[model samples]
Target: MSMFLVRSFDDPKGYIELNRPDGTLPRTSSESYVPWGVSTHGKIVYAKTGEHTGWRGGTGQHRLRPYDTTVSQNRRRQCQSELGVMILNNPSFTAKAVSKVSNAMRLYLQSQDAATAMACIYKQIGHYFYTGGRFGFGRISESKKDDIGVDGVWRGIMQALLLGRLDQKMSIHDAIGRKVLPVLKGGQLVKYTNLATVVRQDWFDDPTRRGRVNAPVRAPVTTKGGISKLDTPAGGTVAQGRNRGVDMFSRDLHRTRDKDADAYYDDADARNLLFGAGISGTTGTLLQAGIAFGKLTAAEDLKQYTLAIIGYLVGGGMHSYHETMAVASKVGVPYNPGAFETSMPESFRRSGLYTAWRANFYDIVVLGATHWRNNSGYLPSHLNKELTSPA
Candidate 1:
């Protein structure tokens, strides 16, 4: 019925005047205050009119009501959650429960995901060559074959493993956008739309702010290549959530609609360096695309490679556009084009491309590795033993 989230909400609080809710508090623009307009009432969220409050924290149409800690205390006293108390008290029991679930999952993944050759892309041409046939994939949810997210999340996992990335993790909390899906309830088909995509990220407000993390468009090959900041602001772009520049991942899955990517990128430098855009800001994404294409397919022949490259470009490009637009449209600044191509860091976790790419990468890791002794090699597993078989 209900689920509890694991991340803290980091959005700016609105300047709430006990009675006056005109989206503004009594404060002059001349006053030096925190990015969150700190007045007698509360946070300086956003003034649509821009007449009284000049600063715009985000693009949310409605302001969040200031939470009262007293309510939580009162609720705790009145009715305590039994499950929460048990989970907190019994650490061993919780660990055992998690292990049981994980063990079952390991079997399922090995049998179906890793060994099974009947995946989305592989189903058609799996048993053909050595490479394509070796790729692994799995599906989640009650999605059909054509769903964008079928191999999406798995792709991200593979990519994370390939890149060995472990920083600035973002957990999907809730989305402010909308997503429509067809579901059959009582054997009847119906449309399902979500209200908001809530997320729990490491740092929503200026992840690299306070002179801590230095986010560039394309990080140098070496430890110290040059000084660069986020060419784009930390607000709008699909990959803006990442400050690591390229070779990273967003790891968020905010299902959004098409109407979200029709605005300009946030131009504020408050979060970026005061000098200018990053080094790779001017560089086009075509090169990046080519690099990725080479790594994935590694086309041996010229003509086939060209044709395959074209197909992948056309398909992958569209997916990237759709996802980036949805992300940019929901939270900050106006819709800016090429958000998937642009922005800081890599938004793989929340990206459809990351899903596909990561899955392929992990296939190489798990199936191709010499750890399992299949008369060959790779991750050792005895779970594949069949009850009855003929030699």
Candidate 2:
């Protein structure tokens, strides 16, 4: 059957030119003037390389062709409207969307000193893209078990809630709007769309630039007094009284993979760091393991994140080596040599195994707070809900 996407096509001669503005067109004698050298002679026909060279923009791939006028125009309009829709529907549209959620999470944290706004925002981003403002995770195409409790875009809601509730308001908007708009609009609130437009036009070419929302990693506490109850202890390590629970939890997560001490810990340091002392208990181990494994089973979240990034394409959610590390951080787990690098066998990375593992992980521990909130509410029921609802 023919797809509805066909309606979005516009001009047949307006093929997407992939070259830089000033770049030369391939087959046009490399002199740089034949920018539109590659043209589609007929509707739906692929562009053929002509004698004149057409240079590509930016990457210089030189794959320019004339798009079908009708198809190109329709697609262009649809894209613009869709982009606007995306901006308007973004979760962080208003202050309360961020503030209410962030505040909810702040109650559990001890201190907000040096808290990062970006980290909080990022946690929610995965949710935003995955849910696509629809709420439910829907049918996950792939499976992973390491994604914690989040299956879609709302995954980052926890971080946002935690950070937003802190003393400082964590805004994911531009500085200019932050300064001028408050007064410009006579104290009326601005939206993510407003801020994103500025960001898209100026500061960053890619809205989803990593480190754009820089989340600072807290320094590890060394002194005994500074340890949290979350930490579990180990033997033979002079760093006694260290609460290594989080670390220990990460190490012994996959019990089936390693019922033995050596299997539980990937390295001697991790094992020695958590062995012995009154700290290790069966109950504690079970509870901690449950939580850790919960984070590891992110199959659904992996599927959702992958789908979101692919569907959005141009939004700031592009894949990065750092995202895996970010997820590890959220779970309070440490990343090893294999998380970001292509070290894992292609079979492991590409196969549905990782995603399946992550999905289960998300289902157990982290609650899909944002997904539930947005989807189950009166959101889809009322257009005026945006006015009545906090977000």
Model 2, poorest ten-residue lDDT window? 1-10
Most accurate candidate by lDDT:
2
TM-score of each: 0.19, 0.18
lDDT of 2 by residue, 220-319 (tens): 3232111122142211111112222222222112112212222222232221111111112211221122222122234333222222221121111111
Off by over 4 Å in 1: 1-108, 111-114, 117-220, 224-262, 266-391
Worst 10 residues of 1 by lDDT: 168-177
lDDT per residue for candidate 1 within 180-236, as digits (tens), equals 011111111111121112211212232231112333334322221111112421111
- Report lDDT per candidate: 0.22, 0.25
Candidate 1 C-alpha error for residue 308, in Å: 33
Candidate 2 to truth, TM: 0.18
